[model samples]
Target chain A: MNDPEIKRRGLMLVLSSPSGAGKTTLSRLLLADDPNITMSVSATTRKPRPGEEEGVDYYFLSTEDFGLKVNRGEFLEHAKVFDNYYGTPRGPVEEALSDGRDVLFDIDWQGTQQLMESAEDDLVRVFILPPSGQELEMRLKKRAQDPPEVVASRMAKASDEISHYTDYDYIIVNEDVDMSLARLKSILTAERLKRKRQVGLSNFVRGLQQAL
Target chain B: MNDPEIKRRGLMLVLSSPSGAGKTTLSRLLLADDPNITMSVSATTRKPRPGEEEGVDYYFLSTEDFGLKVNRGEFLEHAKVFDNYYGTPRGPVEEALSDGRDVLFDIDWQGTQQLMESAEDDLVRVFILPPSGQELEMRLKKRAQDPPEVVASRMAKASDEISHYTDYDYIIVNEDVDMSLARLKSILTAERLKRKRQVGLSNFVRGLQQAL
Candidate 1:
């Protein structure tokens, strides 16, 4: 048996946030601070964007290849968004989790639901919300890349996204960056301790019983 | 309405561990580190040990008073151990939670179940385990307060307690003191983020629709 002190594979951590709510940034911070976690790179049918590489940004595939995988039920979770098929391939994520690593997903609510339905036992969901409506609008406006109408559309869409906050296992208000990040860190740390996630704990307890 | 940024009330954190697993120490560190939390002093028919106080150590109720509270259903949860009745008083804990103060309960598995059944929405249960049987025995031996036979008895009872580990929402292996304390801290922090616990998130989102 492995060392009792060492934790075995952990559950998948799915974080969903509104367009500008900082989930991507939080994911980067977690990966930088903790070595035991890896982001689950999705497989997509869409062509790679500029400077994006296969296997790094995503497992870029043709529509036919993505369709084949979908037919074979190979993906743990998948969805079509904006004319592109995006999916969490079951193989890599399972391998990562079995090796005691946490897999992070930055996806929308639809993807989260699929992941939960497929592997509810191995998933923890967190939703991030902008602290206030005015702040949310301001953040969208500051992007400056989007047209005013697009900003208005996004602001309108954000309300719908925020309405589903209760569907998440955890909801964090993105009021202060540092504080929000700290709260996310604590959630990760605590989720790791969940009885269901710690596979070694059951064996360890049994060993303790026999020794006593 | 109150500020949406403010959390409605603090949570009730229940830390359950087998005898000799150092839960008391963990609870103390959590309280010392978190200003928002309060230790929930339970009422008990058991007499105070050396250096313990009434109300502070426990409510120290007479049998009649304890029975009266139980009869009136004034306790959130209660159980009998070794012929003495111990219970968490409803009034104090409810007041504390409503006022945005977290409460800590260093209780047993049975008491944990009762509290969970009663105030599941408000409770986060964590079970702590000693690293191993040998390590647990070593720690018990170090305490030097109990005789060998008594220690053996306690150890024998530990397995039954640990069997219920899965009942808890979280579990921690207490190998290193500081690390376990950090794990407990993470649990408290993350539990505060549970979507169900946040009262105003839905209304806040609904209000945002108007701004949109």
Candidate 2:
């Protein structure tokens, strides 16, 4: 009794979190669990490591090419980090969206802000937080053998990131990884059912109306 | 390491559908499964049916009382059907929302429109549809021993109701009850975590910032 398959316009799901808030783990689980969504590949000028594959890990570009792409506005959002350039390519994300495949982005708040300006309607921003400041600091300490000053500096940066929670549409506190993952799945599922995203819904409904 | 429990502002979840479209079944399943949401009780001028309890089923009211409440703007929405008046009392729903308990409404499109006008920020509207027009007709016929004219009338009404799908935030086609219920639960869970509904998030974030 179901109608013909409805077409959907995909969304850009941005996950922004502090260094120790478990965003990467949740994103990995989501990609593994949901086949409809793919991780967004960024273009980077940084030299790829031995195991990293071009186009899969990143679109490895030369410095001059990266600057040219930026000037041509090919990147949806780009930034210079240390000496390397990194940006989300506008072409593939738009292509995936038009084909009804969601793109997941693991980006910082600044990158998310840039995407917001370029593609507000297509974006769903979620800000993840650690269970507590103390827990975040502990995770940072345990992750590396960095000295106290380095750990302190990371904590300050995390605090700065956490301050931008208000800028996001949804916020998840990473109390338990499993619970947070479940919440993330729910958010994605719900957002996909949003009226605006279902591109063929009007035609489907109109068909029913005519059938009656 | 989790922060203190944050307060929330509850939402009004309105589910609307035409007759025999599985709305009642889905609503019943949702209420039985979820503890945080409760069915909204309406005040009615109609006499109670057999075994229907006051306040639990409805707040039975006299016609005069209903009129007075309407005059005072106490009802969120009101309507007259046949010889009786029916309305959603604004007081209890408001009280529940302020206490972080979601109120579920099995309303028609008109009632949903009123809620949108009166409480836009608190409202989350979902429109449910039968999987197909033929299925809807079959369900309506199977439910009763009605004649052809009655069935035809119902089909027309369903068509009219389905036309308002654009007015809803989410749409779910009832292909299977279990799947539809799952989608409803996801919508509820996701809407609860929206940033605007989490009232104490600012303070919680501030505490994290200060600790760092």
Candidate 3:
């Protein structure tokens, strides 16, 4: 099924969902299940927390170095959340792509837009939605990451995020976790088959023409 | 997971390929495995062959009836191939769609373009590509349906068909039948999850807001 003989360019599998819609969980499942894909390690100016590896975790960078790379157009999309700068470096991603491994993106709609603008053909966007508002609120409340007031604001933000649903190539109403994971895998499988991503196709077609 | 409660709109899963690329085989696999999809039946001016059941195989029509339907704009896409008229009838497809059943189209690029123009959002086009020109010609010759001259013309036509690779949303290289079928099913699975196709999403979202 992997089609080892034919080389394929990697895809930027961008996954965007509201705080409680379980996109992070889906990303983890995809990474664990598929050997052909890996997490897109981000470059960050913020200090790495304990139990984090340098290359394996975040590519921890000095603030000055991060800013310089941003200026040099090395980062695909850079953003300042509060004081810390987090960005995706384009070089490693491109290298991985040519090496026939896909890079998974866990980002919001804004980062997806930037990626699309830069590499429209390389990107596939999927937006996850909770089956119901009640279910969404219930999940958020269960997470207990924020206070009630914060949860209210998070719900508002979720609506704002869901408004951009049309912008994504696919949407999954994640009612059941297992089913959602299956759908995500299917998307990845199908995206790998895109003609533009298969760099060996033109040559292969020509070879077919010559064979007969 | 089939969300039965949500009356989802069906997708027009169009599979296109150059002659001898095995789209028909793939389509059969898809239909046999999935009960949610059915073949798109066409109305034609040409008489049906032996064992061709009306309504199941095709909607048989007289020349006058075909012309009247054409004038009434009943066809999704129609072409005058040689002297006979063949076209996909719109009503049955739409009815099947609203009833939560998908319609599959096995066609070439020209018909796909017409479907895209008329219902871009509803149609999901996947092009099947042979693994190699060598493989393509070998498959054609193996079929033994045409003479050498006919095969040469078909090979030329295949080259012309492959040129329109960029037009398709997805492409599957039929290097292995099982893998290619898996990719095709994956495409259908993902396309079914599109937010626009899930007509009940807005109402579900609104319900979520109200529950909050």
Q: Give one digit per residue, the lDDT tens place, for model 1 in B1-212.
A: 12355556668898888878889898888888988888998899988899998878889989999999999999999888898988999999999888877899888888888887789889888888887788888887788887789888777788778888888988787878898988888787787777776776667777666776
DockQ (Cα-based) for each candidate? 0.70, 0.72, 0.58
* TM-score ranking from best candidate downward: 2, 1, 3
How much is the TM-score of the A chain of model 2?
0.97
For candidate 3, lDDT tens digit of each residue in A112-175?
Answer: 9889888888888998888788899999889886778998988899888888777888778888
lDDT winner between candidates 1 and 3: 3
DockQ ranking from best to worst?
2, 1, 3
Give the alpha carbon lDDT tens digit for every residue of B45-113 in model 3. Answer: 889999999998889999999999989989999998999999999999989989878999998899999
Estimated TM-score per prediction? Answer: 0.92, 0.97, 0.90
Best by DockQ: 2
Q: Which docking class does model 3 fall in?
A: medium
Tell me the tens digit of each residue's lDDT in model 1 across A14-89.
Answer: 8897777877788888888777778899899998899998988999989999999999999998888899999989
CAPRI grade of model 1? medium
Cα error of candidate 2 at position B181, Å: 0.5
Model 2, A114-176: lDDT tens digits are 999999999999989887778887899999999999999999999988888888998888899
